[model samples]
Target: MERSRIAVAGASGLIGGALVRALTADGHEVVRLVRGAARAADEVRWDPERGSVDADGLAGCGAVVNLAGAGVGDRRWTPAYKARLRASRVRGTAALAEAVAALPEEVRPRVLLNGSAIGYYGETGGRTVDESAPPGEGFLPGLCVEWEAAAAPAREAGVRTVFARTGLVVARGGGAWGRLFPLFRAGLGGRLGDGRQYWSFIALHDEVAALRHLLDTEGLSGPFNLTAPYPATNREITETMARVLHRPALFAVPAPVLRTVLGEMAGDVLGSARVVPARLLESGFRFAFPRIEEAVRAAL
Candidate 1:
């Protein structure tokens, strides 16, 4: 495969860092779109909140991956925090799209892989959702809706836009699973809410691999649900984690306590999204770890 010049926003983030590593491994030249001081010579500093970016820095780039966004689970959903969450994604994506749109047709990157989440589907219970499923009417889904719409400029400019609707990426190193490992080892980790809500997950390695696959496969466009083939319930995930770590997973976190503790954010933890990789499978992309057990074991 021919190498391409890839520019990545949010290069400091988990997914962005993994993508940089993967792209470099695949012999692509990576230019990191940073925010603050130019830490490295190759870094392109931009402030999405301020709607500013170095457009010239993006020139000649063959591809761009927009992963800039506020951390969803980082804080309690205060009205202000929620607004920031929405603005962060919308504004950042719009900034990239605008920059790309300003470029001449031939020089502009051919593809833009924008970040999104399975939360776009809202609480699915046991109903299997794919990219073809309509957007759910809820906070997260609404957030995702606006988030994807923010990239319209790029799509209008004839760029092949891909919305990667990611799931809970399980990684041993400082990801969601890593944060829960200590608690689980101490026997404090248990199912959240009723434990019946479905939890879609993907190994960090496979998540990165899937993104690369999306980038390489020209036929893939629009939204792709980046999840494992085999979806599991919250109880299944917790119990599997316990079994993998040789610990017990008997306790359960009630919904009321979660609601009181997390407020509106509690709904996110309690909600179920039984998402499937319909587009990915149809595109002939095979999952390295299709089952939760395989993903958990690999991450552990």
Candidate 2:
């Protein structure tokens, strides 16, 4: 593969961190967009609030990836926090999109991979959905609608903008799945709510690979679900974790308890989204761990 200079926002994040290492290992020049002073040679300072970014610094880049956003499930959803979540994504995305647009057309990157989430589809009950499916109901779907629209500037500038609608990333140390490991290993693990809500998941390694795949594959735009091929229900995940860890899965977390603790965010916790990576499949992308057992065991 030809080496290229790629600029990335949110380089401090899990996916962003993984991507930077991968790109560097593959012999690509990776420039990071940082909020504070440029800490290192490859970092560029940018403040989304002031609509400022080192556009000139990004001139020669071959691509840009924006994963800047606050954690949705990180804290209690106060009205203020919700606004922060929206602003963090929409404002940063708008700024990055505009920055990518400001580059001289001839020097502009070939593509812009914007961060998105399967939350765009809301709760899908038991029905399977893919990129072609229309947006579903709830605050998340509406937020996603605005989130993707924020990337219009890049698209208008003739950049191939891709909305990577990510799902639950299963890993050992970070993300939600990581938090569940200890509980399940101690035999205190249990299903959430009815344990029937489908959780579309991807191993962390696969998630990173899929992002790289999107970067290399041309003729692909719009939303692409980054999820494992085989989605498992909450009960399935719980059972698998317990089995893999040699523990007992004998408890259940009721919906009301989750609602009481997580407030509005509980809906998403108990929500069902049977999402599949249809676009990626059609584009010939493959998953490293497609089954729940394999995915859980790998995490352990």
Candidate 3:
């Protein structure tokens, strides 16, 4: 791949950090978008809350990846927290999109890869969905719709814009998998709810690779579900983790208990989504760990 300067927002995040490392290893110049001020030579100041960013800092970059957002599982889904979630994503994306659009045509980045999630297809039940699927009903789906739309400025400016509809990433240190590793190792791992909810997951390595694919691939725009081809049920995941860790999967978190403890967040935890990476496959991006077993071993 040709080397070029790339500006990345949310550089401190789990996914963002991994992507930065991969990009830097591949000889790309990475400019991190910081919230306060440019503390380092490679850092650029940007305030999503105020919809402000340093346009001068972004000039001549090949791509601008906006991964800035409040974590979904970071806190309870109180009304205020929900608002903050939406604002964090939408505002940051809009700020970057507008900034990219304002740049001179000759210097403007060629692409804008914005962060998104498979939550757009909320509670698919048993149905398998792909990028062609319409947005599901409820808060998460609505938030995703708005989040992707927040990049209108970049799209309208003729910059290739892509929405990474990522799934539950299987990794060692962060994301949902981070919390699961300890419990499973201690023999406290169990299925959530009925253990029938489908989880579309991808290994962290493949997740980062798919993002890089989108960033580099020409003529690729719109949404792409970054998930393994075959999604597994919560029960399957529990069993796999137990077997891999040599622990017992004898416990189960009842639906009522999860609801009581997790509140509105319980819906997402217990909900089902059997998503596939149709566009990613069509684009010829291959996965290193397409199977749940392979992903589990890699995480371990």
* 1 or 3, greater by TM-score: 3
State, as a TM-score between 0 and 1, how close model 1 is to the true structure: 0.97
Model 3 lDDT on a 0 to 1 scale = 0.94
Q: Considering summed lDDT, which 10 consecutive residues are worst modelled in model 3? A: 43-52
lDDT of each residue in 169-252, candidate 2, tens digit only? 888877788789988878889999999999999988888899998999888899999999889999988888888889999999
Tens-digit lDDT string for candidate 1 (1-300): 269888999888888888899899888999998888768767888888777788877888888998888899888999999989987898889999999989988789889999999999997878998888999987899999999999999999889999999999988775578788888889888999889988899998899999999898986789999999899988888988899889888788899999999999898889888999998999988988999889988886
Name model 2 segments beyond 4 Å from true: none
Cα lDDT tens digits, model 3, 1-300, are 489999999889989999999999999999999988798879999988677899999999999998889999989899999999998998889999999999999999999999999999998999999999999999999999999999999999999999999999999888999999999999999999999999999999999999999998999999999999989999999999999999999999999999999899999999999999999999999999999999999987
TM-score of 3: 0.99
Listed per candidate, the RMSD to the true structure in angstroms reads: 1.2, 1.2, 0.7
Clashes of each: 0, 0, 0
Worst 10 residues of 2 by lDDT: 48-57
Whole-model lDDT values for every prediction = 0.88, 0.89, 0.94
Once model 1 is optimally superposed onto the true structure by TM-score, how far is the C-alpha of residue 165 displaced, in angstroms?
A: 0.4
Candidate 3 ranges beyond 4 A from true positions: none
Off by over 4 Å in 1: none
